[model samples]
Target: MMNTWITASAVAVIAGVTGFFAVLRGSTFAAHAIPNGAFAGAAGASLLGINVIWGLAVFAVAGALGIGALGRRARHDVVTALALVLMLGLGALFVSVSTEYADETYSLLFGEVFGVSGAEVLPIAGLGIASIAVIGAVFRRLMLASAMPEVADARGVSTRSLEVYFLVVMALATSMTVPVVGALLMFSLMIGPAAAARSFTGRPGLAMALSVAIALVTVWAGIALSYRTNWPLGFYVGVMGAGFFLLGRCWAAVRQRRAVASPLPVLPNESGYLPGLIALPCRRPCCAGRSAVPAVLLCRPLCPARASAQPAAPAAPDNFPQKTAAGLLMARRGESSVCDDETSDVWPQLWPGSRRTRCDGFRLHRRR
Candidate 1:
């Protein structure tokens, strides 16, 4: 049982991380296909009395390379068709062969909880660690390349090499998990935890961490339950992993909704330009007048004379918007003096006296 726990933990960790990368690469279906193809190879290896892990790993690497070669053309239909043929045809072939190992065959097919040994756990753990190391070494590069492959190519990032590297890591990791988790349940082990993590956290590192946590919990919990109740371990783990995803999404949605509806303090320089408006310097990050922001917040009522009469604070940089926090638009040196009615109508609505006045649809107005 202890050995089984270690092996399962190793498999779950590999699956969780690789699955995240699979989703990131838009290769979720490919993740599915590789395992199915590997299972076929494993069955064939069993028939020939060859090493099962080696057979599956070799085939998985080849399948991953093939999928990578197909690249953009590896569509959903293609992946599904290939996976179906590999899974069913190999199972049928394995069944037709006479074997003293009928129980072993079924165990490999559906998986067996008690089958994992202490000897097996170390190697699988090594495989998982190696896979994670590869991912870690190239994570930043992968993220950059993935975000803009064309740009990355232009910048000499070798997008093809990175793709091949990721595919290889994915193949190794997926194969490593097969014996412990079974081909059918492997994709769930990979995709579910990562998805749950993503749903809960926007930060990539935190998301992956959460995925590993979820995987560990589900795998261990499933093991405990399976041991006690004699239920199918794979089925339980898969279901729990899926449950985590749904729960994370729900939690994230609730949090986002609360944030969107909650009113908070805003900055005045957030507005771009109202016909009678000007941009202001907002001292707050929470205020809207950030550089590159389309809209800015401003003071609603314009009282330039009053504003001028009031004590002056430290002047912001010359590049700062000429609007005051109270919504008075200040004239810039050697700039256009014309103010139009069209600009006045476009500001955002604020308190009773304050409305979004448009300065080229960029300025905002705040109440005094």
Candidate 2:
């Protein structure tokens, strides 16, 4: 039981830390692939009468490199799937050749945390610490690269290098974690807490802290519950992982609803206008792109969606376009933009002729 706790705790910490970056980097698929590919390593190790960790590590690193070499955002999953197929094929060959692999194989498939020896705890803990330290050193750079690639590029961060570094780290962590949580359940443990943390706060530091805390709690609770119920620890861990993610989704939904129900008031500038809020959303039946947000909440006048919407404009020229500005503004007139008032500088934004000086920019076409 003590060995079980120690080993599980070490693996949990590794999963928690690497999982945060995995989710941030959008490498959750890679996370799943690395360990699945490493399954063959465990089989080969058992056949050779060697430790499973060494086998898993070698194959996991290879899988990570293969993915790193081929992966790109647009078609990353396809590459990951290819790696998975190759690894699984190798695993099948290893399994079919061995008659003594049944018990060891089942243990690998479902995890046997209780069967872990005291000798295994030290290596797992030491390796877990090393992985965490490496992650912490590159945490900020990785976050920038993952969240804002353009900004990272401006700072001279190599996105390709970061991607390969992260995948290798994840591969190492997954190899160690598979012994405790099983390959099938390890991905859930990695993604669950980190994804849930993302919902509560967008700050990377706070979310990482939350992810670790959640993972620790989930592992501890899963162990305790498994002990009491005499059930498999991996099952409980997998369930808790999914439950935490769903809870995060529910929390995010609630926060979003509250924000919509009582929106923050936009402050009025000296000109009683805001730059991005210059025009109200279009209300024409053809303009289905209008935001669902209520216009009254964002600006002074009611939205076109409301029956008693305000009139076109007010007497004060300071608030020139007013709220129903888009309603009155013409989208186009021949080659240039059109405006209700010729002198007003405001024009329909994000259009071809939006920068036109005035509605008279183009002459009306005449059939000669």
Candidate 3:
């Protein structure tokens, strides 16, 4: 039982780190392919009466290097498709021919941590430690490359070599984890926490830290739940991880909404009447297509027809068609920068037909 906990922990940590790089670099499908390739290799080894670990590691590494040879973006989907086909096809073939060890093969696919012994745990533990160290040493470079690949390359970082290195590390981690968590579940362990963490923070470092913490908790909780309820450990771990990710997304969304709703200070010399812009808490539905602003306002009170008859005059700073004032207002409120395109929509709705006269050629309008 203790061995079960240790093995699960090792698998979780290895997977979490690999997943962090995978998601960061947008190589998730490539990382996923390694385990599928390993499945094919493990099945083939079983048919030949060989060590399944050797087969899994051999094939997974081959697949990783093959992807590296093919180039990163172009061959990613192709490699994943091939891996899936090989895994399922070889798995079926192995089952049909091996009547004697059918249960053992299935156990290998989904995992049997209860069968892990102290001796078997040592090798996997070593692999896990080595993977963690390599990940740490390359952490900054990987994050830099992931977020800004072109900038990183311009600054003398070898993006291609780093990609290859990341894939190799991912393959090794996948190979080590397959026997403990199975191919299908291994990827969930790898990607779920990282994905969940992303929902909580835009900062990659914070997300990675959150991912590692989530992985640890899920592993321990899965073991405890499985032991108490006689459930499969991998299934429980996956469920808990997914649930955590959903919770993170919900939390992030709530924070974003709050940020948007908070009041912001208007800049001096900025006019109160921002032109043709939509205000917050608007009922108007926004979409890809154009929609007319049914109502409009100008600081001046005049009859609708007179307002329409008057020459389209330069409007107040905020009331102008120019998006600068609204952008500044949003920035002062501590929210994410609002896109000019969105401000464009709001501008027409709020000011109507104001034009900018003197202020850096910014145009403003009042409702016609």
Q: Where in model 2 is the C-alpha error above 4 Å?
A: 72-74, 260-368
Q: What is the C-alpha lDDT of each candidate?
A: 0.62, 0.67, 0.63
What root-mean-square deviation over C-alphas does model 2 reach? 11.0
lDDT of 2 by residue, 173-268 (tens): 877767766887678778999888877664566778888888889989999999999998878888998899999878766654443222223333
TM-score of 2: 0.72
Cα lDDT tens digits, model 3, 30-59, are: 777788667777877877989888888888
Candidate 2, after superposition: displacement of residue 5 in Å? 1.8
lDDT winner: 2
Minimum summed lDDT over a 10-residue window in model 1 is located at 286-295
Give TM per candidate: 0.67, 0.72, 0.68
What's the ranking of the predictions by TM-score, best on top?
2, 3, 1
Which one wins by lDDT: 1 or 2?
A: 2
